[model samples]
Target: MLEVDGLTCRFGAKTAVDNASFSVQPGCFVGVIGRSGAGKSTLLRMINRLEKPTGGRILFEGVDVTALQGRDLRRWRARSAMIFQQFNLVGRLDVLTNVLMGRLAGVPQWRSLIQLWPQDDRAIAISALEQFDMMPMAAQRADQLSGGQQQRVAIARALVQQPDIILADEPIASLDPRNTRIVMDALLRINKHFGITVICNLHSLDLARTYCDRLIGMSAGRIVFDGVPAALTDTIARELYDLEAGEVMDETPDFVTGTLAPAFGTAAVA
Candidate 1:
């Protein structure tokens, strides 16, 4: 289990994440949603140690990760893989090499720096690519793939880390709806098949509701709602986004109210 207690961050006088506390069970697909400055990204970054918390501590599998240093900290990060919105790839390198980079933590610095990955490491990277159905593009340059394909390559690289946890920070913000579904499905497969805990910051309510096992709604740097998607009533959504109930209902799918989408097309034409 991963536990975050009183997690907080500040930029000068402004507080980004305020007194946040939450727990994530293994294999849970959790989605964090909020407005632009709602501190969602800051919270995830703190968990990943990319951003430091001013207060509180994070405990992962009984270790206080916030206090880890040097090799200990490095080991923690190696086990907890992070995914980004930008699909951070070395565009100049081939896809297989990029995936092999995930093994850098295990391999010696000299070999990694010289780009001399061993056959075992190369085989593992290829397995990751096969899982993502990107083996055919293994020899292609990273920059040649589209945005969605790049993200898949990124996921394959993360898998090679053998991570216990995956933190995706607004991973699909740059993709269209179809690509979004593909990426979300990939995340689900990771969570279900590998039993890796996934904590993602999502921009779209529809995607979050459709994919996440639980929804965490934040407002003004605080979590306003945390529960299953079905329990997220119109009132709660309105409160989370500072909108009216009717407005929330209008924005969400009809299933939220146990209503069916009226069939049109040929029936309307007749």
Candidate 2:
């Protein structure tokens, strides 16, 4: 289990994440949603230790990860992988080599620095690519792939890390609708097939309801609602976005009130 106890982050007088607390069980797919500047990204960054917290602590399997430093911090990061809104692959490197970078935590520094990955690591990278139907592009430069394809390579990179948890921050915000579905489907596969815990930040309620087992709603850096998608009524959504009933996202009422989407990965992709 992962425990986020009273986690807080303040920039001068402004608190980006205000005393947030939550616990996630193993293999759960969670989506964090809120308007811009709601601290959705900040919370994920804190969980991954990409951003330091101002108060409270994060415990993974009973260890206080907030206090870890040096090699210990690096190891903790390796165990918890992060996928960004922008695909953070090396634009100059081949897809396979970018995936192999996930193994740098375990690879000898000298070998990694020299780009000399072992055969075992190379095989693992290839396997991850094959899982995403990206093996054919293994030799292609990351910059050459389309946005959806690049995100898949990014997912493959995260897979080779063999992480216990995957934290994705607005991963599909930049993709077209088709690519959005494809990326979301890939994330669902990681959570179900690999049994990896996934905490994703999303802007679309329909996508969150489709892909996540749980939804955490934030407003002004505070968690205002935490429950299953069906529990998120239109009133609660208004509070989340601080908007009138008619002013929320277009047709949000229909999606929230209508039948929830079948869990992704188990059902056929549209």
Q: lDDT of each structure? A: 0.83, 0.86
lDDT (tens digit, per residue) of candidate 1 on 1-270:
999999999999999999999999999999998767789999988998989999999999999999988888877887888888999999999999999887878898999888889888888888878777799999999999999999999988887888899999999889876677667778887777678899999766776787789999888888888999999876677777664334434544333312222321221111
Clashes of each: 0, 0
Most accurate candidate by lDDT: 2
- Give the per-residue lDDT of model 2 (tens digit) for 23-131: 9999999999888899999999999899999999999999999999999998888889999999899999999999999888889899988899998889888888877
lDDT (Cα, 0-100) at 205 in candidate 1: 72
Q: Pick the candidate with the highest TM-score.
A: 2
Error of 1 at 123 (Å): 1.1
* Sliding window of 10 residues with minimal summed lDDT for model 2: 261-270
Candidate 2: clashing residue pairs, number = 0
What TM-score would candidate 1 get against the native?
0.89
Q: Give each prediction's root-mean-square deviation over alpha carbons.
A: 8.7, 4.7
Question: Which runs of model 1 end up more than 4 angstroms from their true locations?
Answer: 243-270
